[model samples]
Target: MESLSRAGQEMSLAALKQHDPYITSIADLTGQVALYTFCPKANQWEKTDIEGTLFVYRRSASPYHGFTIVNRLNMHNLVEPVNKDLEFQLHEPFLLYRNASCQYTVSGFMTRMTVTG
Candidate 1:
């Protein structure tokens, strides 16, 4: 009888531990998280990417900031408040121009890799 009681107590304790949000780790989720992919073939390159907004939705996260996959900016300007999706061209770099304070421009080609078949 005592062993059964102990098992029930342990089960309840485990359930409470799982529900305790303070103890569990939480993400400081800001901006958009995306996977930028590219492929290189001899002298040419191939690329495919998903913007941040779509990436967030696919991962079951709230996309409050925006899309920023193919974009690359300086660490300073990367914290801007983006909304919905980032409507930029494909394979262009959204760079934080070193001269400007918070300027972001989409230009240049992205680095490439070997795309999987």
Candidate 2:
């Protein structure tokens, strides 16, 4: 848990460096908890109870190669709030931008292995 907190702090610092309007301060990350569960069957992370803006760092190969934000509000203009699980590949990386409230909880699972001899 301590390591995760430190990592969140570092990510917040890096986001600030980007000077992105969507990115918020480190304080926004306070009181936030991250939970992870591994599901070997799917080989993907099932995320739930996510209440915040999610930012994905796009590589140079991507068209919008920068920090792109994804939030429930902007997700296909849904009439109701999201209540379903969002899945992401374990091999891919995901970054949280900011939580809407301090009480919000972010949960997911991921596993990646690198084989280099």
Candidate 3:
């Protein structure tokens, strides 16, 4: 799993563009999900599951608020389909998958990894 994540991070944009389009709709891909998130505790990317909506990132005070989307488990390296409902906020950092062809399903903000005091 770790190796797959690393390989995905190493994928160049040029290579992704050459791959086939993410030729499926959300309804079609829901059951066949491939989720991803950055774990600060683990200090690496990890696979996860999504129930409904996935918040990729919230607008942070810092200027650097972009996120990376990766193709963790998908074999074909399909692109992320654009959905108007998937995006929110204009000025704030929006969910922009760097590689249009990488297969990582949904990118979003997850509270599952929070440390409890």
TM-score of each: 0.21, 0.20, 0.24
**Candidates 1 and 2, the one with greater lDDT:** 2
lDDT tens digits, residue span 16-52, model 2: 4455443333222222323433345876545443333
- Lowest lDDT block of 10, candidate 1: 51-60
Q: Pick the candidate with the highest lDDT.
A: 2
TM-score rank order: 3, 1, 2
Which regions in candidate 2 have their CA more than 4 angstroms from the true location?
Answer: 1-4, 20-25, 28-117
The TM-score that candidate 2 achieves is 0.20
Off by over 4 Å in 3: 1-11, 20-69, 74-78, 83-85, 89-117
Taking the tens digit of each residue's C-alpha lDDT, what string does model 1 give over 52-101? 31101111223332222322332211222233333434443322222123
Which one is best on TM-score?
3
TM-score of 3: 0.24
**Over 4 Å off in model 1, which ranges?**
1-60, 64-85, 91-104, 112-117
Residue lDDT tens for model 3, 6-114: 3543343223333422211111111122345556687766756433322122222332122223344434333333333234322212232323334323344432321
